[model samples]
Target: MAVALITGSAGLIGSEAVDSLVARGFDVVGIDNDMRRRFFGDDASTSWQKSELERRHGRRYVHEAIDIRDADALMTLFDRYGDSIRVIIHTAAQPSHDWAAREPFTDFSVNATGTLNMLEACRTHCPDAVFVFTSTNKVYGDTPNRLPLIEQDTRWEIDPGHPFAEGIDESMSIDQSTHSLFGASKVAADVLVQEYGRYFGMRTGVFRGGCLTGPHHSGTMLHGFLAYLMKCTVTGTPYRVFGYKGKQVRDNIHSADLVSAFHAFIDAPHAGEVYNMGGSRFSHCSMLEAIALCQEIAGRPLSWSYEEQNRVGDHIWYVSDIGKFRRHYPAWVQQYDLTALLRDIHDQNVERWHAGATR
Candidate 1:
């Protein structure tokens, strides 16, 4: 039987990948050490998701509490699976922009070095496995912020005549920008993934994703935008809108949709290819727009405050141009739009809060 190893298996993307792959008949092995709890606290812990997966999938989904930074541990797993491992979906990382500045070492080690370890394991033990990496749009850093943006009532938008008006693409320069510590580390890992595929001929693909969110996300203040927003709405917690008049925009792709893209790449494995993945024009919103949606879902006014200071190296407007991926995999299409996606998150979060499973 074929085996697939997924790092960050309890994460929003990783967990979704596990369920999708397992249902498709692969014996899935997952690696997660609940580092999210360490990164964002108990409220953002994925322990519940991990338990749920094990309870539901049982023997079909093997769970490992291993850190990707531990090369020996990763190598052991790689050797154990050997040639049977047909896919490696790496989603584990210290995913935070502001948090990265606090501990650059931990962020870099986890994001950059951890990716290297995974690549080496694939090369050494399972060279033929399809390696799919979850990179971030932050890789373009503040470069996107340089675009001509107009302030709408609820969101910032690119000039209609601009090349990137539709959305930013992979062609955007990752150079000469203020990439936060997190973005820099991801850039290092992203480039390395490409080099491994191009230089060594490994089947690897890098997806530069926008706001990836869903019900399974352990949404925290530092990351998981849409999910975290829903969490705040469900609990009536005060939500902070940082800078750009809360009009900074982001395209959110459902976790399941992103994982489907991963499966597409795996089915037709490519080398060193990069795709900007997100909702694009089909779905996106600013903080203000999202707050309105959250309020509608909760049937109450959301408690939110504004901060004049924006996040460092944050984009003013970013919707991914998924044209390349769509062109490559013609069968791939978005399963959920923004309204349906937010509703799913709102309903799930409400259920979790009622069950006393969330903060």
Candidate 2:
């Protein structure tokens, strides 16, 4: 049996990936320390993920409460799995862009140094394994803003006359803007994952994704935009839009789509290859667009307020050019577009919150 090891297995992306892997017949092991709750002082939704996995898939899911920073613990997990491990999906990291400012070093330790530990552990214990990393569009920084933008009634966008109404491709420069602390740390991790592939001949691939969202998300007011918006709409909490007239655009890919990409990458492994993974032009939407989606999905208008101040490093418009990935994996297509995706989240949050409401 093919063994797949996933770090950050309790996270939105990781947990969804686990379900995807098991359905495809991979014996999966998940590891997480739930540090997100510890760091943010908010409820972590991972407990449901674990319980759901067991309930749905029986005993197929194995879990470890292991922090990636602890090299010994990581190695011990690797050692136990040993030769059975065919793929190592590194989804663990300090994922928040806002918190990186408050705690840059801790971000570095987890996003950069912690990634190095995973690579080193793989090198030591699972040399022949395929390593897949989840990187961010933030690595491209705000340089895209320098490109001429056209203001529409609802949002700002790259000039339609430019080569890509399709969206920004991988060749777009990442060096011009001052990447925020979170971007820098992720860039460090991104480069090293490539280096491991280039220098050590490990089969490694990096996916610099835009907004990755799903129902399993641990939504917060500051991040996980779609999830937070859904939560507020469902629970009657207030929601805020930070800047750019609440029309800043982003392309969102569901966690299930990302898992499909992983399966595609593993089937046709690429070494040191990086691609932009997200909803393309077809899946892109603005904050106002998203709020409208939420309103439509919930059958009521959202209780949201607007704020004019922009967050540091926030982009006015961000969308991925998925042509490269499409060309490579023609069979792999997005299962959910923006409307359908938001509806799923809205429905899930409604059910989850209602269940709690009854309790």
Candidate 3:
């Protein structure tokens, strides 16, 4: 059986990628240090990801709890599994944009240095493996916002003359950015992955993602926007909308869609290519709009509050232009629209939390 190794396999994006890989009949190996638990306290949990994957797919997902920064351990895993491993979906990173400054060195180590470790391990142990990296739209920085925005009922957007209102294409400028420390670190990883592909003839690709959400997300207010909204709505937790008068727009794509893109890249390895992966033009929503949609899906009113100040380096508008990937994997078009996505996530949050309350 062909094996695929996934770093951060217990994370929201990583876990979903694993499930998708297993369903597609790949022997999957996952590695994580459960740093989320350390980072977010008890609220950070990944056990459900493992248990649920087992129950649903009947695949005993092999996992190793090791920090990827430990080069020896990462190389050892690759050495052991190199024979069957054909792909590496590099998804592990320090993801909080606002918090990266508080722990800059740690963020740099995980996001940039750890990626270097993984890439080197692949070079030594599985030189032929395809590497698919999960990058962020933040890498484009704040330039997209300067393109001339017009506010609608729920979100801020560019006027028609401005080309990117539909979404941002790969050609968009990444120079003018205020993406905080998190974006800086990720950009380092993104560029390094490309350098490896360019200099060493490795098949590496980057997926610049927008808001990626699914059932397994341990959503916090600062990150995991869709999951946080769904959880807040269902649990009646206060949902705070920050900045732009709750009109900041973002495109939310399910992790399943992202996994499909990852699989496509693996199946057809193209060296150092980058593609934006997320909801297309039609799948975007503003903060207030999303809240209203979640309310409709949950059949209840969410206790909502807002503060005017924005999070540091938070982009006012970011929707990915997936036209490039669409051309490559036309069949991999989004399976869930925004409404269906909201409903599915709402039900999952309700079921999981209610079960927890009962237990």
Candidate 4:
């Protein structure tokens, strides 16, 4: 049996992977201990999603509550599946910059060390398995913030004539900038994946994702940008916008689109291939633009306030250049733009958001 192993398997991307890969007929082993709850509180818990995957896929989907930080447990699990593990999608990490400062050690151990554990396990038992890592745009730290930006009515945009107006690509350096602790840790993990692929001939692809989002995200104030915004819109919860006149821009990718990209890489494997994966110019929005869209979609004005200070290392404008991925997987296409993305989020979870708000 072809087995696929996924870390953070209940998360927005991971859960999407579970559903997609199962439909492709791969028996999937999912590793997640619900650390997101520990990092972002109960509202961000993915336990509900975990139970749903098991229910829907049954014997085809195996859920392991093993912490990726626990190497011994990982070795045991990897050994059990052995070489049948044809692919490993590592997405589990402490995902919030604000929360990372509260416990740097916890963040490093989970993000950096946990990744190492997965890499080593794959090398030991299934060295040839296609390893797909969900890295972040934060790996560029505040470098993107230094781009030549022009402020428009609703968004901070890169100067139209600038070379990167198309969008920031893989050429952007990941050095010499403040990366928040979360970014630093992710950089370490991202580099490690590259090294493993180069040195050991492992088939690994590092995907530096922009705002990865979709209806599956258990979005919280500390992370999951788009999800949290729509939740606030639907639930009448007050939202806060930080700095950049609330016009800072981000490109958002639906989880399904990202997972499809992962499958593309797995089929035609590469070693240490790094790609900037996000909606790119196809689907991007500013804080103000997103708020307006959410309000329009949800048909309710969000109660929101702005603070002068933005989150440390937050980008003023960032849209990924997915040209490389497209050149490689030309058939892969993005299905949702900003308005479609927000509308899907609202349609899927309006009921859940309303119920949670009452609590």
For 1-359, candidate 4 gives per-residue lDDT tens digits of 99999999999999999999999999999999999989888888999999889999999999999999999999999999999999999999999889899999999999999999999999999998999999999999999988889889998888999989999999999999999999999999999999999999999999999999999999988888799999998888899999999999999999988999998999997799999999899999999989998999999899999999988988999999999999998988888888888888888999877777411
Which regions in candidate 4 have their CA more than 4 angstroms from the true location?
A: 357-359
Local distance difference test scores for all models: 0.93, 0.85, 0.83, 0.93
**Which digits, one per residue and each the tens of the lDDT, describe model 2 over residues 1-359?**
68999988888889898898898899899888778776655555466676777677777888888888888988888888887889989998887778899999899999998999999989998889999999999998888777788889988888888886678899987786877899999999999999999999999999999999988887777668888787777777789889889989999998888889998999898888899998877678999988888877887778889889988777888889988888888998789899888877877678777565310
| TM-score, one value per model | 0.99, 0.96, 0.95, 0.98
Q: What lDDT does candidate 3 reach at residue 346?
A: 72
Residue pairs in candidate 1 whose N, alpha carbon or C atoms collide under 3 angstroms: none
Off by over 4 Å in 2: 357-359
List pairs with backbone clashes in candidate 2. none
- lDDT tens digits by residue: candidate 3, 1-359: 78889998988889888888887788888888777665555566666576666566565478778798999998888888875888889888888876688899989999999999999999998888899999999888777768788888778887877677578899987776787889889999999999999999899999999988887788776668888778877777788887889999889888887888787788887898889988877578888889889888888898988898987778888888899888877777688778878877777678876555310
Tell me the lDDT of model 1 at 91: 97
Report the candidate with higher TM-score, 1 versus 2: 1
Q: Backbone clash tally for model 2?
A: 0
Query: What TM-score number comes out for model 3?
Result: 0.95
Q: What is the lDDT of residue 352 in candidate 1?
A: 66
Q: Which ten residues in a row have the lowest lDDT in candidate 4?
A: 350-359
